[model samples]
Target: MKVKLTIKLLISMIIVYYITMTVYVVLNLVIYNSNITFGEKVFSVSFNISKFMEPYIEDLEKGNDFSLDDNNINKLTQNNIWIQVLDKENKEVYEVNKPENIPNSYLTAELIEFIQDPWGSSAPTTISTNNIAKGNENYTLLIGFPIDKIFRFKMTLTDESFKYHISIIIFSLILMTIVAYIFSRNLVKPMVSVVEDIDDLKNGIYINKKNKQGIFKEVSKNINNLSLILKENELQRKEADKAKEEWIANISHDLKTPLSSIKGYAELLKGDQYEINIEEAKRYGTAILDNSNYIQELVNDLSLVYKLKNKVLPIKFKEENLINLLQESIIDLLNNSKYSNKEINFNYYDDNIILDCDKKYLKRAINNFIINSLEHNSKDTIVIVSVLKKENNINIIIEDNGYGIKEEDFKNIFTRYYRGVNTSSAYNGSGLGMAIAKEVIDCHDGVINIESEVGLGTKIIIVLKN
Candidate 1:
């Protein structure tokens, strides 16, 4: 990965460098070929002046008095150039197209000043100087151009200085390349690790939580959080699957027991070898009916739970007296011979606590809670059901002094098909009672909370909007 990233970065840098150098070279070519009369190109013209005046110098050496031909003179005039030749006495020996302010003679110091600041003269001009030698005689030639026509910029460099600057440039580029590599490595390393982490997540491997640094810190944190969520979801899925298996097994057993009884009773009645009395036959028939009723109840509970979970159950809401509903539910439970021995009490301050609810389902939900308390405890255990009005809401409280729910079962108390650890083996319930109760309360936009201890018993509070 590092090698590939390094190669990619190097390629990118090379591309950038190539483009920059290409632009620089193209710009230089354009400037060199253009007809601009300033900068270094114009400075090159000053060097060419020596060659332009070479023929005149030869003529002067041959005693031609520095005379110019028509072609050469035309060239000088078209370029706006003036020429002056001076002898050892600093007197002008030959001149052409000289300006009106030009002096015929010059002092050495004045000539030096003019050379230093060519534009400082009254009739300013850019000047170029050349020396001419003919045997023992010597002369100075001055070529002058119009002021501002040529820009004079002087730069000097020795071999050592040039090499030093080149070395510095090379070193700077190397250092920058190293820095870029390090920076990219820092960025890419984390990116690669994150990719690997995602791949692991895809394979169902969760990452351990840890602190991360650099720009990818947030990304790492989010990935870790996702892993934790996914891990938790996986655990929940497993638990649900295990619960489903157990529920199916329990249902099979519960159904088989009643079905076997039903089959045995019907077979016994149909057997011709057995002389059954009318009372015995009636008892057998009743037993079969009871088992069938139990199976029907289990199937109905399962169906209702499914409807509630899928939000397919329709509820018809109407105004009902909450206290009267509780009283009726308690009375109905007491009427049942099974729960007639259970010591249950009902208490309420208000006789008319009104609420919007589905009467049948709401009563079923309340009865499930009361029955749960009765079935899970001793017959003598005191079960108290109370209704209270608090402001604009109604609270129904069910308290029981019985074998309370275990701590481990609290989390899954309202979960469908989740039987508690302390549930009796003889109590062959569908395990949807509490879950249905909670769902029904939720359907009414109410909240139900349970508090329980190992021995002190359990308290369930149902709060509803008035």
Candidate 2:
């Protein structure tokens, strides 16, 4: 029924109390019975004394010299004994040292009369009489004693005994409760550890590396191993996603080259102004070469992406002069087929801007942005590249006069396979360039962000620690 610890302890204590009380009552009954038996023994001795004293009375009537020993009488009455004796007139003739504090009363009168009367039909077995005939007359010698002293002794013993018994019960209960509390905590300790581990798992924190040992130790170890398995699965999923993006990019580039080559050669075959001559053949040949170069470039870029994902690429990070690196990157972009003819605007503040990074990946990231801007924009639109040095970081902003991204789609532009609204129908590149750039920058502990408006131009901002 899911009882709480405190409640269970209380119930146990109550049961102990009742059991203790029952034992106490039984003990009192045994003690009282013993006192009753002792009372009967004392009464029997008094009866025998009365019988022995009757013979002395008979000798007194015969004028025999009686040497009564007072010491013997004193011993007989010293049991807190109250003896009553009566003569022929039904009068109290002898009353042994009864307490005066009791005050002479009708109880004495009733006791004397009852004694003087013949040991009647209503004789108590606990009291007795002897008839002593001296010469001729009949005299009833009645003797009786009050057992109240014995009763008082019993009461005193019972009161003291009851107090000690009750104390023992109380002390036992208190001690038991303390012992029970310690025992319960020990029993629940392992469960508490398990609960804490489960809470950590729920919060996505690492489990304890220590090997578990307890009643539930096996379960705990199993859960810990399961967490490791789940983490490995998550890592594998990310790797698969990166590989899928690389495959799509390679396939797009491959298809675009053949398609471009076919279109270009077919156009040259149909001469525009010149006649079908050797010049047309050379033009067609050049178009075929351009397509083949495009295919080669696509294959190389795809291979590089694969190496980056697989950690097979030898990315050596060294302190590089930022000015020279950016300058070479711009030259390469200008010499590229897609960006060479575009109107490019460059802004740079010449300084000893140094960075610790792989120069190849950095260049690829910048090249992708430059070529993307030139190819996606309308004919002859200007692409601006600017590098700004801040106090603790460097900011590189690449702005293009092409249509910017929509507000709803801005956040996901760097995601692999995401094609923004501004993408032209003739765009030949895969949608992984920005995603790859973002990943590279992340590995360098840097950030890349994009700010754009629907109709205005888009700006890509890269920030790296100085």
Candidate 3:
């Protein structure tokens, strides 16, 4: 059977308490039977009895009569010990009710020996004696009890003590059980609550928050935090699904335009719709090739986006001159028929400084940046570029006085397929320019920063290794 943590803790604490009480009881019993116990009590009763014996001894030492205190005698005679008063010569002159097997009189040396090594197996563990003075005469007094009889007397009193002992045991059991219950409940309550909270999460239900204190406060707070994270993730998943649907629609639109052109041109070429010459044939052929190239370009862009996003593209790195690469990319873009009319200017201030670079990817990143500016801005827009060396870093800055990004869309400008509200269809294109640029720069262990104001302009900063 599966046991809950609370039950286990309760059982464990109860077992420990039981073991502790059992040990205490047994230890008390052992101490009662040991020689140390005998040594401790033997002198306690003897001192009281000595007070009664003082007068008896002083008179006896003078060969006169003496008396005893009956109450003191009774208190001192816990064990059935023989009590006696003797003269200096060790002759017994008086006797109290003593235990059997103890001799009436003793030679001083025999009594001394018995005191040193007590005599019988079931007798007093040892003897006790005291001296008295009477007119300068000396006397001795002795007492002995049976060890077996003393243990019997103790057992008799212990029988009576069981009434209170059993009461104490029952009382203690009740108290400890209550304490154990409270302790185990506190220890296990938080964990059990957490388990239930997890179950609620699995059921797609939010956990109800409650005020908790002590050690469980952190636990409750963490559970709430985890709930918030899962809730946010759930919301993000829904938004991503919606965004993906719109993105697929946009991609379909981009693909249809070129495909329609290709199909229409091929049909025209195959038809007898009009008379054709070399010039017309060449023009038709160029239009067909242009549409095909446009479709090919779209496919290539999608492929590169996926490869970079999934990290499936193999990239090779070699030491290349970044300053030269940037200048050439701009010059080549100016040479291209598409961006030929765009007024692009660049300022360079460095020689060939070598750095590890993947030529195709890095050049693509710079081209994407330059093209975004030229294509997005008007023909009158002036694009300025500068390459500067600062200690260990090479900084490439591109600035354009074009229609800038809106503040709301600035944060998401690099997210895939996220076209800003202010960006027109002519400028945003596929909405993958900045995202791809950022990813490529990141792959090179470099950084890209954009500073744009609503009506003024946009400036891009690319920092790379020198």
Give the number of the best model, judged by lDDT.
Answer: 1
* Cα deviation of 392, candidate 1, in Å: 2.1
Give the poorly placed runs of model 3, Cα more than 4 Å off: 1-12, 15-163, 200-212, 221-239, 272-277, 423-428
Model 3: how far residue 258 lies from native, Å: 1.3
Per-residue alpha-carbon lDDT of candidate 2 for residues 24-127, written as tens digits (9 for 90 to 100):
99877776554344455454323345444554455434543222346545744665443334446545444555445322333555654544442331432123
Query: If scored against the real structure, what TM-score would every candidate get?
Result: 0.70, 0.45, 0.66
Please identify which of the two predictions, 1 or 3, would achieve the higher lDDT against the true structure.
1
Higher-TM-score candidate among 1 and 2?
A: 1
For candidate 1, write residues 1-466 as lDDT tens digits: 6568766876687678779999999877775565445554334423455555687666666653567777767767777888888888888988889988989889988886776688777767878888877668799988788766664656688999999999999999889788777876777788778888888899999877674788889988999999999999999999888888899998999999999999999999999999999999999999999999999999899999999999998999999988788888999999987778778898888787788899999999999998888777766789999888888888899999988987668888887888775653377888899999999999999999899997889999999987
Candidate 2 Cα outliers beyond 4 Å, as residue runs: 1-278, 407-409
Total backbone collisions, model 3: 2
lDDT of 3 at 127: 57
C-alpha positional error of residue 450 in candidate 1 after TM-score superposition, expressed in Å: 1.6
| TM-score of decoy 2 | 0.45
TM-score of predicted structure 3: 0.66
